[model samples]
Target: MSILITGANRGIGHALSRAWQSSGTEVIQTARNSPGMEPLDVADPSSIKELAERLEGQPISTLVCNAGVSLDKFDELETGYAPELWAESFAVNVTGVFLVIQALLPNLRASRDAGIAPKIAIIASQMGSQNSPAGNRFIYRASKAAAINLGRNLAVDLESDGIAVGIYHPGWVATDMGGDSADLTLDEAVPGLRKQIDELTLSETGCFKSWDGSDCEF
Candidate 1:
């Protein structure tokens, strides 16, 4: 069995891949059309299907849907966010997550049959909080909120099959997405995320948590 992490070429995804690899766990790292790695555009159904076919019947202990985007980061509420930006963000951050899990269900089931409890970890955001202090980046927040809802429902549906699902906020980090002024570094975020993922079990499915293990409101 192995772990599959989407968008593993950089940022939090890359950090999680390294952490698992350092512990001698097999890791399947993906990037969006990147060379020397599995090319996976999470927004593309064809991409998800092809990867699923290729890994068919293989046991996957964990699947991390970490590929996401924040396109309207600098957009102002009055004049900036185009409709297309919302579509693009949802394609990657919301629908993409559901597609990956659907495509990989068989793999997760295989792990369960093999006496391993498989997992699905979604990299959502605290900004998606239902009681969010609204001011900016509504597009990003909406997409993440959808993802959290998806994870929760999926948890209920996949429970009979023994697959656990978790949605988490990977803290503000100094990545290309999270600017240098962010609160936590990748170093701090990845370890906390790892702890959450490693401890995930069927009983704890559908949890909304922060990288530091703090409880988050839906």
Candidate 2:
């Protein structure tokens, strides 16, 4: 099987790439400004088009939209969460995910044509959950909520094409974005995430799940 992962230079993306590689799956790793990998800036339409063109006849069984930014992590409630930060966050976190999937629709169809159910795994966050209330990181939270909504809608739209779309919370791993104090290591999270993707099917499309395979509030 083949997989395409965005932002695979580091964090969970990188870990997932390495894990898939070790299992002998063909993995296409893309990142912004990363050498020896596909140069893709999900926020840039031209870049997404270029990558799509480059991978033109290749079948992508799974597309993991893992590229995201947390620009408002330290923004204060009273004085921060600047307007520009909101734009930047949505540009990459929400819009970028949609753009990549939109550009790669043909490639995903290639997998479906081969009798494989193409899967879209969106790396959303628990922060996006309306059921959970939190403070700070307003921009990140809102963008991720938009991402979840995007995945849900895509699940509906893409189901006829035999594609499954799932939104996932990768858990608070000790990545730069998650901070050193976060629970779960890459080792713990990657396997669970892989399982969630591996088991995703047309029947389960639009499901919001935690890395450990539990359902998450949409």
Candidate 3:
């Protein structure tokens, strides 16, 4: 069985992929446009279908849905959050996540048949929490919230299949998306994320947690 990480060309996904590889774990890295990586545009159903067909019988022990966008981070409340932005954000962040999981169910089942309890880790954000401070990035926050909700429901439905789903807030790290002022570095965040995924079990399936494993309120 192997781990599959989406959007692995850059940011936390890149860091996570490298870390796993360095540890000698079999990792399948995918990106939308990166050379030397499996091509996948999570927002594109055809792209997901192609990937599923290619990995036909491979058992995936872990699936990390890390492809996302924060399109309106700087837009003002009134003029921001364009309709197209909402559509694009949800397509990638929410619907895309569900589609990938649905398409890969067979692979996850293969992992189960191999005696592994497969895990799905969704890289949601603390900004998605209803308790989080109100933000200007309305579309991004809402999409992440939806992702968390989707993970929760998937956890419930997949329990009988021995698949665990955990939603996480990858700490705000210094990246193109998180900005240089963000608190944690990739070094600080990726390790904890890996730990969370490693320790996920049916009992912890529906958890919403921070990178450090602190429980998060939805």
lDDT ranking, high to low:
2, 3, 1
The C-alpha lDDT values of all candidates are 0.93, 0.94, 0.93
Q: Give the distance in Å from residue 37's predicted Cα in candidate 2 to where it truly belongs.
A: 0.5
> Model 2: how far is 154 from its true place, Å?
0.5
**Would you estimate the TM-scores of all the predictions?**
0.98, 0.98, 0.98
Show model 3 residue runs off by greater than 4 Å.
none
**Model 1, 95-202: lDDT tens per residue?**
999999999999999988999999999999989989766768899988999999999999999988889999999988999999999999998889999999999998
Error of 1 at 40 (Å): 0.7
Candidate 2: TM-score?
0.98
Off by over 4 Å in 2: none
List the lowest-lDDT window of 10 residues for candidate 2. 130-139
Candidate 2 per-residue lDDT over residues 7-88, each given as its tens digit: 9999999999999999999999999999989999998989999999999988999999999999987778899988999988
List the candidates ranked by TM-score, beginning with the highest.
Answer: 2, 3, 1
lDDT of 3 by residue, 1-218 (tens): 59999999999999999989988999999999999999999999999999999999999999999999999978898677789999999999999999999999999999999998899999999899888768578899899999999999999999998999999999999998999999999999999989988898989999999999999989
lDDT score at residue 61, model 3, on the 0-100 scale? 97
